[model samples]
Target: MQRRRLLKLGIGAAVIIGVAGAGIALIKPGLVDGKLGPGAREVMRAAAQAVLSDLLPSGAARDAALQAQLARLDATIAGFPAATRKELSDALGLLGTAAGRYALVGLSIAWAQASTQDVQQALDAMRLSSSNTRQQVYHALRDLNVIAFFTEPANWQAAGYPGQREIP
Candidate 1:
């Protein structure tokens, strides 16, 4: 009887915590109309610059390309399933917070204010973190940036991927 009562209490507590967590996540201000909100966008832009710095040439060209790629990323994220989108938004929200930024990226400042090297260091730390969730966030952000960058026809040459070959 004791074991059964304890099991029931544990299950009830788990359900309550899960419901509260979901409620808090839904009320977070980092998402706008089921899309990447401003805070998320800022984090992603900084992350993109840090992750793709080597491939991006300097000056107006790089700026233009980054802007276009960010747009593509935004569109792609907008189409993600609700759960996936919520996870991403939550991650972004955490990174946007100063305490979470320091914990994850080793920076106490906002991502926009952090230098590229600092952002890179943070991302590297996340990639190497013991936490699987941190690693997942790092990989997901990097993958999105890479896919958006490499899929452009202009970048195909750089990646040595010839435009779609016409099979006779």
Candidate 2:
């Protein structure tokens, strides 16, 4: 009976450790890579275009700025807490899926294929959505995009902020 009880206890301990390991793996999925997958990156690019359209110029300049901004965004995401990273990862993954895209953004087309106007409309709807989840997702993307856009020194001039005053 003593040997049987010890074996049962060992099995239970192994099960607990297995479950915890799986949970941690789920929470940190791909975070160590420090970059978004292609589909996720496309979604973020479309989102940035939609959110910062007024600030972003048309043509090659806009594309160049967007690439820099995405790099900044990726760096920012890489430093986020595990829970925040997980949430953002989950949201991005959902945005990449056709069904999730339609459900969340009301668009049948893939995010990369969606027109600027269409992407803007979808983001606007999300911003004004009654659902808390939708609004949260909108806010997260919007905040990231705005931060990435305004943090660039080139944009500071446009925003009317002179270079930092040197402290003597």
Each model's backbone clash number: 0, 0
Q: RMSD (Cα, Å) of candidate 2?
A: 10.4
Worst 10 residues of 2 by lDDT: 23-32
lDDT of 2 by residue, 19-99 (tens): 654454455333336677676788889989888888877889988988988898888888789778876776676666665
**Over the stretch 1-168, how does candidate 1's per-residue lDDT look in tens digits?**
699999999899867755654554456545677666777777778888998888887889888877887888877878889888777777776666665566556776687788889888888988999978678878987998988788678877776777898899
Tell how far residue 23 is off in model 2, in angstroms.
14
lDDT of 2 at 99: 55
Let me know the TM-score candidate 2 reaches against the reference structure: 0.76
Q: What is the lDDT of residue 101 in candidate 2?
A: 73
Clashes of 2: 0
Which candidate has the highest lDDT of all? Answer: 2
Q: What's the lDDT of the predicted structure labeled candidate 1?
A: 0.76
